[model samples]
Every structure is written in C-alpha cells, then in structure tokens.
Target chain A: MADEHVEADNAEAIIARIEHKSRKIESLLKQYRPVEALKTALEGSPPNTRDERCKSANWIMVHRAIMAIKDVDGMFSSLDPEYYDILMKYLYRGLSTGDRPTCDQCLRIHEKLTERAGLGCILRSLSDTVNTV
Target chain B: MAAVEVHRFAQCITCHAWSPDRSMLAFCPNNNEVHIYTLMQSKWEKLHVLQKHDQIISGIDWSARSNKIVTSSHDRNSYVWNLEGSEWVPTLVILRLNRAALCVQWSPKENKFAVGSGAKTVCICYYEQENNWWVSKLIRKRHDSSVTSVAWHPNNILLATASTDGKCRIFSTYIKVVDAKESKTVSSSDAKFGELILQLDLSSSWAFGVRWSPSGNTLAYVGHNSMIYFVDEVGPSPLAQNVAFRDLPLRDVLFLSERLVVGVGFDCNPMVFAADERGIWSFIRFLGERRITSSGPKYGSQLSGAFRTLYGQPKHGLSNDTNDHSRPQGTVHENCINCIVPLGTSGSSKVMRFSTSGLDGKVVVWDLENQADLSEYF
Candidate 1:
C-alpha cells in the first residue's frame, strides 16, 4: 500500500515536470526560437549536477528546442545562425527521449520561430496591432 | 472524431493545387480569372486574382519547384503565370495548331510543359533564361488524334501523351528513351521519338481519364466503356503493353499510389480498387451523382443537346445538385461519367471525380486512402 502511493507520486511528478518545462519553453519561444535562447536560458541551469533530476531537466530543455525545429528536418542545421555543436547536441537529447515532444508545443514554438526568421514580420505586426485593438 | 467536411471552395472550382510546402492552394473557377487561396487566420483568403485566359480554360498545372502556374485554354492559347507577378503574362502562342487544345501538362521538373492541340499536335514549351517565359519547341508528328491527356514522370525526364488515337506514348526532353533495339538514353532529336508505349483501344469509347502511378511504373486509364484497365510497367519492360481490366464502368482512374487506384462513375458509384497481379475492387461503394457548380456550362444553350455529340462545349444539367436531398437527382445512366479530375496535384491527388448527372454536373472527390467522400464537387 505504501509502494502504490509512491508510484502515484512519481507519475504526478513526471506530469508536473513536463507541464512546468513546457510552459516555460513556450514563453521563451514567444520571445524567440526556444532553441536559440537555450544557451542564455540554461546559463543558470546546472551543468555539473549530472544527477538524475538535473540531467533530466537539461535533456528536457534540449528536447523542447529540437521539437521546435522538427517539422523541417535538417532546416535548423543549415539555416540557424547558432553554433552547430549546441544544436547537434540537442538532436541527441531528442533521440534519447522516446516520445516526440507534443505537436502543440512544437507548433507554438514554430509560430515564434517564423517571426525570428524575419519571413513573417508583417504578419506578426498585424497580430500585434489586433491584440492592441 | 466527428464527421465533417474539411476543405470547401468559395467559387465554382474548376482547377486547384496544394503548394509544394502545403501552405497554399492555387485554383481557377473558369471565370476568365484565376485565384490563389492561402490558409491564413484559420480561413481562406484570396491571396491574388489575375485576369487571365480569354477563352474557356482547359486545365491548370502547378510547377514542381515553386508557386508558378501554367494554364491551357480552348482559346487556342496557353499562359505561364508567375504566382509572384503583379500583372497577367502571356507565355506562349504555338501558332501551329488551328483548333482548341484538349489538355496541357507540365514536366515533373516544372521546367518544361507539353500541350495537346486540337490538330493532333503536341507542342513543347521550355524556359529560356534570355526570354524569361517558356517558349515553344513545336514538335511535329505528335499524335494521329487530338491529345486527350498528358502526364510527366515524378522523378525523370519522361513525358506521357494520350490522344484521341486511343494511344498514350512517352517522351523525354533532355534524354530520349527509345526502344529501337532496347530502352537506352540517347541525346539526339531523332532518338526523342516519343516511343509508342501502350495503346488502349478506346476508339469506340472516349477515354476521358488517364494517370501515371506515383512511382511512374504503371498507367491507369478509364473511358466511355464501364471498364478500368491497368497498363503495367510502361517503362521498357516486356509487360509494358499488357492490358488487364476489372469490368466496371469507371469514369476516371486516379493512380494515388503504386498499388492503390480509385475510380468514380455513372451509377453514382465511387469506388477505390487496388492492384497487384490482378486488379480487385477493394472498396466498392455508392457516391451521390456528380455535383455541378453554378459556374459550370449548360447544355442545349451551347449546341446540340446530346451528351454524346462530338464537337460542342461541355454541358451540365439540372439533376446534378445532390445538396437538396428532398429533390435528389435521378440515377438513370449509372455508367456515363465524362471526367473525374482533381483541382490539385494528380499524384498525391486529394481532388474528386467529376461527371454529368442529368444536365447538371456533379463531382465527388473521394478520400483515396479511406475510400470516403472528402467533399462534394462545387
């Protein structure tokens, strides 16, 4: 009976962790490519913990960024202005995570990526104007 | 999931295409105009409309590389409209053909196009960097009869031309594949003789539909007869000309995949059949009679009021509107389907089959994968 409660807590923890990280990633993508913002966002995140929780958090962030660019494969590598090694390392993290990070999160991130890429500036400005109205 | 139609058109849609990125759709309503619709703000917005095609538009083929559009018309003219251009552009005028053209198809590479002339000539229009528009090659000795259909291979330099001769032949622009001794690529003009591939004897029956497979290995054809035949291995194999048929009146044969072929016709029957060594009707079901758009033509108003008449404008009748279930159209001639073409890409074809139900035209685009009605022709 005690073991069942612990298992329930573990599931709850996993769900909460995913939800918390997803919201933060979405907010960062609302500003710019979540993948591009990683180095800065993770500047304060632990690098040495290597503990299961710490390593898992970093892996989740990297996974989030990779999901942001998964629609057009090989696009981030060729078009991104960021260092190739960081993005390459992120790909490894996504492969490590079994399931693809949610489609909705990727779409939210892609919408932000389009604005950063400078192809959809007019559309972004129109959206901004509508929100202001 | 709830049952509902996904995509619907605004005007009487005659032709359409999904963009290479699947972000946009190009369509023409045969209204002396062409328009591009993009999925913006979760709805369709007319991106651009160009005043083009002075005469009755025949068909529209989107280029493989970009958003460019090439349209052929019965006005004895063809135009290449650059999607990004501000004004209408007349790309080519093949002065050789005297009558209205039946069909026009762009090479899979989208760099070139082949148009069928009423005079039994197939003219090739290719792009030249100096001119900026595709100019004509005006190849002679095309087909003995008016060209009925044209299809380009998905990944090669091959082109197929089906004509009133009840024959469909293959052509190559850059490299010629002729079976003089055997199938070999030769670079000479003499070697480019569109090797007489497979010929289906539909002289008694009007062959209205023809499509090459996604892999371009086999060809599926449908005609006036209630039969669909698979002409296998069109590329230089001993089985290239072997014709096999599943005897059902098929108005059109859309080759969606290598093995899956779909057809629709007169009996208000919209069916999808698959092929391996033999063709089998995997999904056989009834679709309501064809759907006619308001912009479609009316019979007797144009010429002789007969459906089988040779030379006259195509007609739509009063019985095609299946929208009003109370006044449902009659299913008299269950096998008289004239044409079933999609407004978009024929290869990954999401479009429907079009046919005459009474005087009105009714079109039903089948979801080739699920073998279900995706949309009513409008």
Candidate 2:
C-alpha cells in the first residue's frame, strides 16, 4: 500500500510536468516559432532513463512542431547530433509498439532526416546508442 | 471493359513518363535515380538508370518529338536528358531556386520546358546555342506557395500552373526567339513573357494537378479538397465549375478528350468527369471495379474505428491492410496514383490507352477502348 502511494505520486508529478511543457510548446507553435518549439520539446528535459515522459509529451510536441514548420529542410539539416539519438530511440520504439499516429510521425521524421542529413546520421544514432550502453 | 494491365515494382514510383514510340518508360522510384524500362519478349527489362539528382525526383516529362526527358527533384535542380548512342547525357538546367523543384514538363513544341519549384516560382527553360547549355527565366510574383503541377497549352506558349496556395494560374511564356507567334491569333496578342493571363482561386485546399485541353481553351485542375475543377474559356465569359467528389484528395488529372477527364489520387482508382457542350461539368463514374467508398467503412462508423485503433485493433478486420502501408489490398494501385500520361499519337485528342504510376510501385496501363462504355461513343 505504501509503494502504491509512491507510484501514484510519481505519476501525478510526470503528468504535471507534461502539462507545463505542452503549454510552452503549444504557445511557441502558435507564435510560428516551430524551430524553438521543437527545441523546447526535445531538449526541455535531460535524457530520461524512463521513456514514459519523453514519449508522452516531447514526442507528440515534436511531431506537432514538425507539421507546423514550413522549413522542413532547415529543421532536419540543422538538428543537433544528440537529438538524433533520442529520435532513433523513439523511432524504433514507435515502430515496434507505438500507436498508428506515433509510428507515422516517427517514420516521417526518419524520412526527413534521411533526406536532409543522409543515412549516415541515422546509422550514427544507432551506433551511438550501442556504444553508450 | 476497361482493359487494365498492372506491373509491380520493388519501390514506389513517384513519377513516370513514356517515350515517343511508347516503347520505353522512364520512372522515378521515389529516389534520386530515374530508371528507364523497355518491354522485350513480353517482359519488362531495365534499360538504363539516369542518376544525377541528389534527392527525391518529383517529376519527369518525356518530350515525344525531341525524344528528350526532363526531370526535377527536391534537390532544387532539374536536368534535361538527351539520348546519345546508347547512353543518356544529363544537362543541368539553371533553375536558380533555393527550395525543392516539384514538377517539370515539356512544351508542345519540345523546344523548351518548365520547372515548378517550392521556392514560389516557375522557371521557363530553353537551350542556349551560344553557351551550349540550358538557361531558365523566372515567373516569380504570382504564386505564394509551392507550385505542384504545370501544363503547357497545345499552342506551346500559354503555361498553366497549379500551386498549394489554392490557386491555378495561367502565364504567357511566349519566348520571341524560340517560339513563333502562331498562337497570337487565338490568345491575347499583347501578352508578353512572364505576364499573368488568368489567376483563378481554386479552393482553400492545395491544388495538386492541372492540365490544358487539346484545344488550348479549357483547363482542368484537382485539389486537396477532393474537388475537380474545370475552367472553360471558349465562350466570351470563362465558366468555372467545381465538382466535389466524396473521396480523398485527387493527386493528378489528365484530359482524355475535349469533354472527358480522368483523375486519380488517394482513392487509388481512376474516376471520370465529363462536360457537356453547355460547359456543365459533372462527375460521370469511376473507371475501375474497385469501389473504395462502398467497401470502406462509412464516416458514421469512423468514431468506433478510431476507438479500435487506439487499442491497436483492426476495425472490422477489413482495415487490416491500412497498416500494411505500401501494399493496399484490392486496388489497381496499392497506394496513391501520382502521375498519368497519355499513350497514343501526339496531338490526337482521343487517346485509347494511358499509363499511370503510383506510390504503390505499380505502373498500370488502362485501355479505354476496352474498359470505357462504348454506348456513348458509338
């Protein structure tokens, strides 16, 4: 009963954090600052060992920002290398277990990344993940 | 009776064009390279690979008279290919755009071509004998968004452009040196190069394709709003009609005759639109046996379908193929049909057979003489 209480509190905290970040991302998107919105969505928090928060808020926000952004070429080409690792992590996860919309977004990002930075960027992300583990 | 022969490929064919004799086919596999295939001994064989672009090729146009192919790509570059002996030589046309080039087409005369770009401009390119290279002039100032498709008038001077900005525009691309002023009797005499003739607001939706009829007076275009619109300019006042079909957005439109048009897109079937002499355009019928609307669940059941999808369950067991992505079941094209080109003698308004390539990696030839109802024709 005590462990269950702790788990509920943790879930509440995650939800609260997601709500705050989602508001920031949505406001940025409304202001037509998609690049800034994308940055905030992906880099707002440190790398989470638990991907629940990362996949829930950040992933959806990133997808929304991408759909809103006019300069898809610019966004993909100018992404930080570290962000690709996060993207690939979600991409594989989404492909294997994500919902249809999530999987679609992941595939779209993969295509854009491949188009802008070449297959090397995606391959590099995979290798980085393996080396880190 | 529409005789349809479908050929499947390993990769999605983003665009396709046919050679003059209808003996060879050139198509882009949604990649940087364009492949040329020819049928020999009743089997299609890969003949050549035109590799020049560094990005996805969006458009391909084969000039029947000159036997040349012009291709445009997301790399912001367009190349004109000339067949030399057995190999193809690519001459890059200077489009001078920073964004992706979306569509390319050869004019009726084959002396020049046009390239539409996401940079909000269409470039009219012609060969310069002095420099021995192709050069382009910009038609900037009209389009506010990416140009999706372009069609040249049979007269070879008037060019029609469709854009994602919800507008279909006509421009006078009459180059004095290359094109003779034969069309001046029919078109406006005072029209100069880069002059906007007509700018019609199609819809709030992005316009996908445009085509000029053989007579050069009628224009047909499709939009993302699932609408097929036609503008008939033969009368004193131009008449525009919009037919909103209850289906997904159409991607391409081709004029089969003066009064008939075929549009294909996300529905994965070719649908016919016809116009009477009064210029009243209407949706006639679909050309294929695949009835997407009848088989697919109605919008009333869409909420339940969404709920089922949320649980990762297939709605009604029929929508299982939706997750398959490329291979859509029970259709001539497994995905959206992207390009359609007529196959017959040039300048003939009545084409018996036409070819279509789609995102499903299938190239199909639909014979109208066999498939279309002949009661009306007879």
Error of 2 at B238 (Å): 1.3
What TM-score quantifies how close candidate 2 is to the native fold?
A: 0.68
Top TM-score hit: 2
TM-score of chain A of each: 0.39, 0.63
Off by over 4 Å in 1: A1-133, B1-13, B39-43, B85-90, B93-95, B174-190, B193-198, B235-251, B265-269, B276-283, B286-378
**Per-candidate TM-score against the hidden true structure:** 0.53, 0.68
Indicate which candidate wins on DockQ.
Answer: 2
Alpha-carbon interface RMSD for all candidates, in angstroms = 25.3, 18.6
Among all windows of 10 consecutive residues in model 1 chain A, the one with the lowest summed lDDT is A124-133
- Which residue runs of candidate 2 sit more than 4 Å off their true CA positions? A1-133, B1-3, B180-186, B234-236, B292-330, B372-378
What value of lDDT does candidate 2 attain over all alpha carbons?
0.75
lDDT minimum window of 10 residues, candidate 1 chain B: B354-363
What DockQ does predicted model 2 obtain? 0.01
The Cα error of candidate 2 at residue B183, in Å, is 7.2
